[model samples]
Target: MTEASKYGITLEKLRSRAAKGDLTQREIRAYFEPDERRGEAFAPAFKLTEFVDKQGKRPSARTVTELYFGAEMGVVSGPRARLRPRSRGRGITTTASAARMKVLAEGDSWFRLPNLSWPVSYPDDLVDVLRQTYEIPGVAMWGAEIGHMVTVQKNNYLVPLRSGLYRHFMFSGGGNDVLASVQTHVKRFGAAGTNPSSAESYLKASFDGALATVIGHYRTLAGHVRSVSNPKPTLYVHGYAHARPLPGGPYIGAKLEALGFDANSSLARKIVAAMVDRFNVKLKAFAAAENAAHPTYKVVYVNLRPAFTSAADWNTDEIHPSDAGAAKAAARMGDNIAANVPVA
Candidate 1:
């Protein structure tokens, strides 16, 4: 038996990561250390919420809400969206196998946020399919306050961890984090004929750093799961599809200039769009690598950009999906989940 064996994960799992030079058994185990700082480590108390058991009994859980970006960014205070709970016969939504999955979410605002005026984001699409289509009791959700990745990490958001059973984790982020850093990249690279060195380096460094921190938290969550289940829970992540600027008046480039950047012409839009592609590429690579390294549970990447034809038609803004756009986007993701996820 290996170190991970004691936690319900296998030695082969750790070795696989070590084989790829990602992580070693000792490093993976270190992620689970209880004797550590708050933001620096993964262990934290579970939060209590309005959710109840299958029998309507509330579990004695000391639930926690990881508050970071939402608090400071005012992401939730904007405007309330029209929320309509799906019509349901009174009972817990269950999977076909009758297991309740706990889904924990965080990241940027593209995941059909609260007060966004849209009734449903694509993540909600997952709930609708599971409850109405699959007839599963709706799983409990820990909606990490909306914010950028760094904000989520700074607050130590309670990413889904290993428990007795498998839980579902969804990520609809990276857009905001990537967009925030766009100006730096745009000014540095947009001027050149092909590539901008300074901007590219900044974007590369920022993205890599952000990705590394997030995976550390991810590994920490998996490590938590490892202590409880053999085939741990799966994490679902998506790449924001390419978005183009609106045709009229204020293009994304001009907007960047307003915010103090080098985006003087249409090239800014192209530059930003290019960065979005780079972000998604790195995300896919990261997901594939983690999936290959760990057998406890895998990372599934949903490339959502291809689902849309024109970014202007689908996006309410350059960064967010419109109501009509979200409906279609949600449907595609729901279909993907139904086809790929084998909870039943």
Candidate 2:
């Protein structure tokens, strides 16, 4: 029998409630919070891989690809793509069975982060950490926005959903959308006479629209997933960690500086934090509404913000989490999934 953590209710109890169809969302979330500190060892019993466009140029992580995709990248060369095991004498088999491929994942860089390092290997992303427990196979690009996932990348995820091979779905997106908004939605300076300490000083009147756009795209994706997945698989979506800005960093930091806010200033960090919190709130609301309307095919939002309060949790890039930070967030996600859904 699998053991439950000392902090939260046992997995047996959660499965019992779920089997009887009485498990509430609040109860599942209660189990999510206390499991933030849990970490798993790096022993991959199965292949950890995602699908990439065969026609387009691949993303980074050339050296560490073997850790996830065995010797060769699982290039979708034919009509159907399949995963291979790791080359380093790992336990994963060359081909995965339908029963083993129960989880499907889709989203942006967080889902498909690359090991950009050359001499030194900076592996272990969110998927890498989570796959320590579940074998995730789907589509995730390095810089995918919600819009991209729904349109050009639609077939990549939809085809798998149509196959009815998966029982659980996971997603991570909208962070890139928020970063894109910072470039255009921030003001040159704070509003006249308003306190510099507030987020309103740095944001423009149109910024709220940007947030709405993210919510709308998320809804669209959820709707797409619902239309095809049979027996209504559980959809788990996660908002990003608390990412602070560095002056020299890319995207968020560079865009903030270009908009006239000092990327390293207290006000700037507060503004970023405010935006991130707002995004999470929107996600939480969406999950509630979606679940209320469709009980069996519930949408679960996993908040990763609490695990990343300290600076040490983030990498030098400031956008992505450090190895330790990824482990923390992954533990929360793995715990949430285990609590709500039963996996063989």
Candidate 3:
């Protein structure tokens, strides 16, 4: 029997379970765990965590599963990292011990993705590589939307940006903003009896409005940074790479299935690719506009589409890259920072 038949972890099964209620950790874990009897050597990137409360009481199975998924995925239920407050009238500032930091990073899971421990130790995200050059201190959480980053959590990053210590500001967001509500942006094929000629056409007809909303958030972030930050740190932003339709990318498989498309279909890939392409294009445009408007405090768009080329470079989820993929993106970002922003 196939893995789906034997393991019951098929997309259809997962969709059904997701539709009904929360899926238990046991179910998701068992699905990803290698079958020793089958001699499968794969090691899952996701790890299960304990779900007991501080009172040492175990929650219900459903609650345990909810906590498991939240912890494993680094879901942002609360502040993942916080900036410490310093002396009087100083407000929130880096501690004296951490005052030497040169870069302030803020964004979603990519900035804080945990290291993969599958076959060996490797750099799984940009934070790992960035920490090599500069002490990165800021708020980067899992599943953070750009809108949240700009509005509700503004001070989380804004206060640090005003410190005048950071010369480079690395941001890794906008992916979640677009990916989370793709159903709204992308239309189902054959909708309104429309026979679109190309993926670009389909996207042009529907995704622009959603993309515009995301860009508005970016503008808000840029405006805040420009106004608040003393010495005005140069902003660095990146767009997502061409991703695979894996189950992990914002639950892509189920989302595609819900939209009446096979997760592995060419149309699905094209749809995702089109969205990513437009996002990158708009980012470049945004960077250009910002740079032209404010010559001193510039916005640099780091192109990371070429980072993950092979399947080996991507994790099973296909949203977060593997160690090799992260290294490539880090290299690209490092190169861009070096070439564009001068040293302090």
> In terms of TM-score, which candidate is strongest?
2
> What is the per-residue lDDT of model 2 for residues 1-344, given as tens digits with 9 covering 90 to 100?
22233224433443344344343333333332211122111111111122211233332343223222221123211122223212112344335433353678888767765322211344456776665567776367556678878877888778887888777788888887665567777776454323446775666667678778888988888888789756567889987866888995666788788867788887778778777877888899999999888765878899998888688888777777777787888888887888877555
Instruction: Please write out the lDDT profile of model 1 over residues 101-203, one tens digit for every residue.
Output: 3344444444433321122222233333333333222122223322333243532333324333335555565454555555434444434454333334334
Across 5-72, the per-residue lDDT of candidate 3 in tens digits comes to 44454334443444443454344454333223422112223322222112444344434333333433
lDDT for each candidate structure: 0.43, 0.63, 0.63
**Candidate 2 vs 3: which has more TM-score:** 2
Error of 3 at 103 (Å): 0.9
TM-score: which is higher, 1 or 2? 2
Q: List TM-scores for all candidates, in order.
A: 0.53, 0.70, 0.67
Better of 1 and 3 by lDDT: 3
Off by over 4 Å in 2: 1-72, 75-91, 94-101, 115-120, 192-196
Q: Which portions of model 1 miss their true places by more than 4 Å?
A: 1-104, 115-166, 188-190, 194-231, 246-255, 258-266
Local error of candidate 1 at 295, Å? 1.3
User: Which order, best to worst by TM-score?
Assistant: 2, 3, 1
- Pairs of residues at least 3 apart in sequence or in different chains that clash in candidate 3: none
> Which pairs in model 2 have colliding backbones?
none
Candidate 2 has its poorest 10 consecutive residues by lDDT at 39-48
